[model samples]
Target: MSEPKSYIQVLSPELLGRVFDAYAHKPDEEKHLIGLETTLFSSCESGFYANPVILSHVSKNWRNISLDRPTLWSTMIMVRPIASHIPKVENWLERSKTAPLTLQIMQTIPDDDTPIEPLREERTAVNTILEMLLKHIERWEAITFFLCIGFLPAFAEFPQGKLDQLKSATLNLATWSTHPQVVDRVFRAIHAAPELEFVSWCASFFQTGLPDHVPWQQLKRIELDVNDISEEPSSVGYVLDILSKCPQLTSAKFILGFCKTTTPKALNTPLNLPNLRSLALDEASSPNIAYVLQNLTLPSLHTLNLSLFSDEERSSANLFKAVGSLVGRSKSTLKYLGLDIDDEQLLKLLPFAKDVEVLRVGGAKTKKFTSLLTRNANNKISLEVLPKLEYLHLTYAQDAMRPHRISASTAALNRMVVFRTSQPPATPGLKKLKFISVGTAASSFQTAHITLILGTYSHLNLKSVRFEGN
Candidate 1:
């Protein structure tokens, strides 16, 4: 006997489509508020397919409705290359129609750590899938690919005219080892993307390959990870050359492995990035960063993130000096500052950022930081150190791991909040406070003190308080 369909399944196509559309557009509070990161789960996992895919398999009516909804299939997420799933990929493209697309392709390796070359069947399937996607390249709005370098040739084979609508792209190359011909071909293909606004290229490329193919002046956001560059000295030149070409870049982030300074002539040359609003420099202890900062003139910069990681003490001294010089050369127009330095270093630099309204501290304690927000003995806060700050974001957590310092930090935080709220006219109070605790105990925060502060500051328009635990 056949099972009868329920009332929900028997609804009209229009009504069903409306329901699904509403569900798709609903604000995902959990993802945003809770800081939920997107994870690439393997197909062997139970819940591989998301809502649209699962809905199509419900009944005949639902399947028809889902197929008709073009928006439902515009965003396709693939775990890896699977021969059997080619049919599904084809169906998604057919249903997507002419709508703009967002594709995320995660190329995962086998469980046995075997090379993908031996997997002929999977390789063939992947090639077929890539061809189909290339056929519809005009509809690519945002694309993220984590694929092997072997696929570079396949990408280069595609025609350039098809990438008219491409806007954002993230390419996580599997290997840094690539031939010059392949690199040039790949960059040439990317250069054809006229509307490309955001690009994240996390791989090593020869310095000479840049500024030739890519339209650097058209890009607004760029993130580069050049950890595999062979020569340390050439890395600085590579960054400077790219920066020189990108005058229209509004936001840029660099992840450098080796720390080396630029040449004297390079440092002497002044580069003006008028449109740059935000810049982040993440290096593994490089004095070169300081020299780079000293040479550039960023008139529009408002947000700066400097995350320099090194084992030895005093590695960040040169960086700090460079930053101070940069701030002095540029106007004190910064509104937001994010730092990953230790206590003493941050204290030394906060005075230069007096105009900063929002501050985000990562990988450091908030204990000494609270002093910056506090009023001195004369009941007057220093006008030269974060005096206009209204938003505070702490990326570190007070937990059992650091039992000795946790209580002190908590107390300092409490006092800072209390002092700021009470002396509003003399010192601007924080209007919003956010805490991000990743892989840590969320319960470590003092709920009683937070509640009391909220209750006390209810009249000061201090309503936004967020504690994000991921």
Candidate 2:
């Protein structure tokens, strides 16, 4: 009898080719594929079967089809590249032909016990890899680098206008010392790229602040994360200055370290962002966060996220008031709001954003907020707070300082969900709640209770209900 045919041998070439293409572009949470040399490494946790390079070795027919598809080889992720992989990199680039390339060059972060110095051979390998990539600069569509500051000089050699196809770039430069001159030169090279629109710049603090030569007018999205370890933290005024230059930005995020105290003269006038739609500010003191909210006028803002790590209660009170005033002054119809604040502060800020459709909060105590959402003694939803809220996400904040603090009880959550979902369709200005996600301690909420809630609400046509345990 003839041997039985395997799955690969029985499938048609066209169907197999489509499968190969889909696997090549599938998103991986870990992005564990080391590079083009997939056979030399293995990720025991995620498995190597997801790598597209593995398909070529399955059979002769599969190899022929893989070689014929150029786009399948366009994306290359190099993690701690070495000299031995040079030939594989060349072969991969050659196979991509003229297709646009998406590259991610990363290095393993060293722990405290590990040496910070790069091995002599590793430096040679990195330099050679970058040199090869520069030869095809015109085909770069998106590139991300998580490397040391020493590599910034290599990018200064990029010819102007050679990055016409580049639309996105992420520079995560890290080192113990600052290099303002090198950083400035790199920014100058980036400014010459006319097609660049999205950028994420993360680095340690620089005394000179952000470069002024960037193509800010052409950018639509930007994220700046500056970790300040110096005696004087960067000022919010400097960040506002950068935003003033970007008139075309629709989304912006600023994650600064400790912020310097703001004086009345810091912001002489209110800055207007007529086109911005989304903004997020994180890790600043309460006063600094309030300072930012007080000086900005976002007429088109729809989504906002604010997080503070300050311990001053008075400043937090001021921050809440500032938020309410900003929303009221802009008269913008906010659709989404996220806050890492307490229940009282959240309640005070929600009234100004009554049109918000989604609300996310992180706090140790949310009983009061959930009660406000539940039907009152008259069996009616509150018209004054979040009348149009459709989705609610609550994250339990486990602070070591307040170990006895309790989160929203399971009973409170169930009642709130039932009340919001049971609202009559004829109710004016009130929308039925469709989704709820709760993240709390495992002991507080059990899987059986969640199952019971799902069984009870299944008839209400709710979209989804999720529970995550810590």
The candidate maximizing TM-score is 2
Q: Residue by residue across 1-470, what tens digits does model 1's lDDT show? A: 99998788677888888787665544443433211122332211121334477777877778888888998777776665577668877887888899898887766544456665645555566677778888888899888776653444456555756778889887755353455555555556666788888876655353443335567879898887665433344546566777898878999888765545433455665678888899887753436566578788888889998765643423545566777777777663788888765566777778777678788765555566677766453644343456666777665355322221222355576666655544444444423333222213232454554444345444443446565443
For model 1, which pairs clash? none
Model 2: weakest 10-residue lDDT segment is 39-48
Tens-digit lDDT string for candidate 2 (1-470)? 99999897788877777778777766443444432333222111122224457878987888898888877787776666677756666887898899998877765555556455543455567668778888998898888876652554455455666888888888666462456555555556666678888877666335445565678889989888645323466677767877998998899888754666663454667788888999998766667677788888898999998766533422544666887777877878789998765556667777667788998776544678778778543554365567788998776434542122335666787777887776565566677789887654322443554555456666665798866553
Best by lDDT: 2
Q: What would the TM-scores of all predictions be?
A: 0.74, 0.78
Each model's backbone clash number: 0, 0
Cα deviation of 190 in candidate 1 (Å)? 1.6
